[model samples]
Target chain A: MRHGRRRGRLTRVSSTKDKLLDATVETLRTHGIAGVSARTIAATAGVNQALVFYHFGSVDQLLAAACATATAQRVEVFHERFAEVGSLRELLAVGRELHTVERGTGHVAVLAQLLAGAQSDPRLGEATAAALDMWARELETVLDHVLRRTPLAGIADVAGLARAAAAAFIGIELYEGADPQGAGSALDALDQLGAILEAFDDLGPVASRALRAKVRQVTSK
Target chain B: MRHGRRRGRLTRVSSTKDKLLDATVETLRTHGIAGVSARTIAATAGVNQALVFYHFGSVDQLLAAACATATAQRVEVFHERFAEVGSLRELLAVGRELHTVERGTGHVAVLAQLLAGAQSDPRLGEATAAALDMWARELETVLDHVLRRTPLAGIADVAGLARAAAAAFIGIELYEGADPQGAGSALDALDQLGAILEAFDDLGPVASRALRAKVRQVTSK
Candidate 1:
């Protein structure tokens, strides 16, 4: 009887923690970063405000924890898809799909709020950067695999390119809220670049050698 | 004597408005968007808090005016340099220089705060996007001029590319606050792209025709 009761109590506690995390994201989507508070989060979670301090120590801690949890869940969902990416163009296609899904789920709004909050708060900044790093790491792995055989592998900074791609998506996500058409055009422009890259990959060996030489020559200067 | 006194009073009022505008930007620099208020702005300006309402009607209006004024001033300063840009690589060079200057002035921090605030506040969002558009307009003009003879003119969306460039710089600015080295690599990656584009511009006519044909074929599907 005692063991069963202990397991039951642990399950409740874990569920409550999950509730708080969900509440944090919901509040960010609805109220933005400025609306976040102990009372607000507890209210959103339908738990006692004291439970927040008891479970997470402070609001900032809860926010940091929430950021990490939310980002981890989203990243995990996309991991298998990321692993299957075969080319730069395919990677961008996945990015477009991720953008659509994230925007629909309101994750993009939450991320925008967190990133904004990060500007003034060092703790929040670290948490947000850590969250972005999660995406960048996933992209870096794919870039390493896909670009290894391309001419870009010799001249491109794969790690930096990954971050740049991440940043571009982030920027487009926020930019879209204001100018949807412009954002679409930006995505299309990126797709065009991806197509060019794919073409480069399809080049004959002789043409590939000449293109690589030109890229090296231009970049060296 | 009455006309002279009236003129003097008008001068004082205009100067006070200017002071508030300057203070608004300073507050954004030091306190971020959340910290901005009539009290903080007035305190920074060393003036009566009531003057913010008297001059601009409300804090949001004051912020909107400040954003417009500050962005206009900065854009004007760069107008001559942008007009002189002869190639895509030169434009990137000017961008690097502008990034350094903006970072030093703490304008990047201010922009990050406004952009974050924009996510939640439609009023601020409009103001921020308007400010971003000012920069984008300048860039579009340059991109149109520089890419006119290049193959990208037919394949690239110039307006979209301009916004993408602006978004990239904005993303890099905020990303730099968290990961400076990663930001540097991102900028370098863009420089590499610019170099590649410039090299394409230098290609012989036959090679350019072949490249354009390949790009179109790849993009068509």
Candidate 2:
């Protein structure tokens, strides 16, 4: 009987934790950083207010945990989506698709919250930066692979390209958040992608060769 | 006596209003959207708490006003910078300069706030969209002028290119925000800009001619 009671308590505790996380995301989406309060989050989770104190200890810790959860989820999603991209064109396509999915899911806004709060909250900023760095490294590896196979001379500044690509992705989120209907045309996104590709080609033989040499030198070093 | 009292009241009110706006921006930069409050902003501004309510009426209105002020300032700066850009390279140069200024001042973080907050606030969202549209229109005019002067055959997809360019600009902001050290090198921003310019050239002589023809046709019609 005692074992069963303990098992029941454990189940309740786990369920409460899940609720807290889910509530955190929902609150962030609807009310944003300013509106989220421990009381509000607990209310959204349908748990007692005291449960929040029990699970998170404090609101700052709760927010940090939420940011971590969101960051891990985003990194996992990027890894999965990029895995599907094989060619240069396919890579751009995947980038756009992933951009739409992430923005629409409110993940980007959550990220922005972490970013905006980061200056005041050092832990949140560090966590967000770490997540972005991981993604950039992954992208760099993929670009290196693509460069190795292409007829193009050098890797074409993978780090630079990745940073630009990431900016373009986030920029869409910026516009998408402001004007979903307007941004829906996808015209802007495609145009930028085309520009990135053209820029790659513009480097031509000399720039490409230099870039390739640089990539090799850096990777070796 | 009434007139003198009125003048004194008006001066006090205007000063209070200016102080409130300044506080809002500082609070946004330091604490972000979440930390903005009448009490908090008032405290930051070194004014009485009630002055926040007296000047702005509500937190939402205060934020909206702050957004409007910031957007106007940015547009003015961009227009002044790009007014002299006569070629594609010059245009890219302007882009680099604009981003450098934005990053150094952390104005981009303020932009991030509006971008993320727009998800929740329709008024702010519209304001942001309107700001972007203005940017697009200005860039389109510049491209249109260039197309007219050139022996180029196809129409310049100015609107399309502007949208793409804007996306790239935002991308630069995102990349720089996430990776300040990388941004300092500016490899990513420069590479992305090069890509956009190359693509602009590649829209082809045929497309350029068609675009010019279309422009003529539309203007005439």
Candidate 3:
């Protein structure tokens, strides 16, 4: 409890904890939630098995901590980049990159694992909810900007729009992971919307409408 | 080995198998994949524990069969009804209904449980992929008809549009289920789109564009 002297032990404790957490995440990524056990995690961390109980108390606690830590890290990776985007189109591109496992945050697979277990495990469910809430909060800001600049403004509830778009981004990732063709069609449609929105923004309202009539005539064929 | 002689036991055997499968689905709903076991399912089905393996060979095979059967039944519940919808508006409404746990298919929760395990288990992953494919195929047909009737038709790749829409529908459901706000925002935005599209369809292309511009002007203020 001595202020300066215990600081050394605290540092040692924190580092050991970090290593254990890292091993837990690695296990989740490679073996999944079911594969995570004190033995395997300690083996992966190269720590004495007793140290796991000393640090985290149980495998479940270690997993919950791993999920929080991994989710927080992923949020940091995307948050800085997404917050800087000036338009909806840029956000979608970043989202596309983040959703794919081979390309970006492999968090989706881990998230799916948590979500599945969350329905039955209250602690895991709360963790899953907190992670989703983090996403929804970030998206609301971007959608506010996109709506204010576009011809589609006032078209719906802004809050709802943000949530829906956020949901679609996640939905795309989950479906793609399962489907392999992924959301190729949905992303294509999104790209078209970005192009159209960019063009329509430059055209002004009256001209944009006039252009739509022409676009309809062409697309209708 | 004669085909006709064992038919009586065949009928009783198959009935017992069906009951075990039904118990598996119910257990998945109440407890989750991790909670499924011969003991739990046999108790739920009011049968002897050995009967589980005797009927399905193993707990894993029983769970897989349960997933497939439940998914097929849910798909049947929504499929023909969706195929008959007259417009995008109707499709969205139906999709919304099908996504929720209380109001629609409880498959979302079951699917979530499967997807979580799918990452670690090759067999579970394959089963999940097949189930999702069934959903996408049905949604594609509905979107094809909706796109054909709307001004948005031919604006982009119809296949992608269908897939993206299907993804969004799914994304909304999953997020809502996890978050507990119930997809209010996503659904609200969808309803707005439905309103806008319905209005646009009736107004003719030129007028609809004019109306959208006016909407922008109002929203911009």
The CA lDDT of each predicted structure is: 0.78, 0.63, 0.66
- Candidate 1 ranges beyond 4 A from true positions: A1-14, A204-221, B1-14, B204-207, B217-221
lDDT per residue for candidate 1 within A77-170, as digits (tens), equals 8999999999888888898899899997777667766776776678878888898899889999998888888867767667778888877777
Lowest lDDT 10-mer window, candidate 1 chain B? Answer: B1-10
Count clashing pairs, candidate 2. 14
Which rank order by lDDT, best down to worst? 1, 3, 2
Best by lDDT: 1
Candidate 3 lDDT over residue span B1-221, tens digit each: 22222344544244677778778777777777667789999999888899998988988777777778777878887777887888877886786667654334356666655655566677776777787777777877787787686555545355666677766765665565567673676777666655445444654566546545543442233
Point out the worst 10-residue segment of candidate 3 chain A by lDDT: A1-10
Measured against the true two-chain complex, the DockQ scores of the candidates, in the order shown, are: 0.47, 0.30, 0.33
| Candidate 3 local lDDT, A21-76, one digit each (tens) | 77877776677665667888888988888888998887767777777877777777
lDDT of 1 by residue, B1-221 (tens): 12123344644344777888878989887777767899999999999999999989999889888888888878888899999998888999999999999887766567666776677778877888888888889999999999888877766667778888877777777777767787888888787777656656655666667777776775566
Candidate 2 local Cα displacement, residue B210, angstroms: 14
Task: Write candidate 2's Cα lDDT for B53-119 as tens digits.
Answer: 7777778778777777666667777776677777665676676677777766656566666666676
Give the DockQ-based CAPRI class for model 2.
acceptable
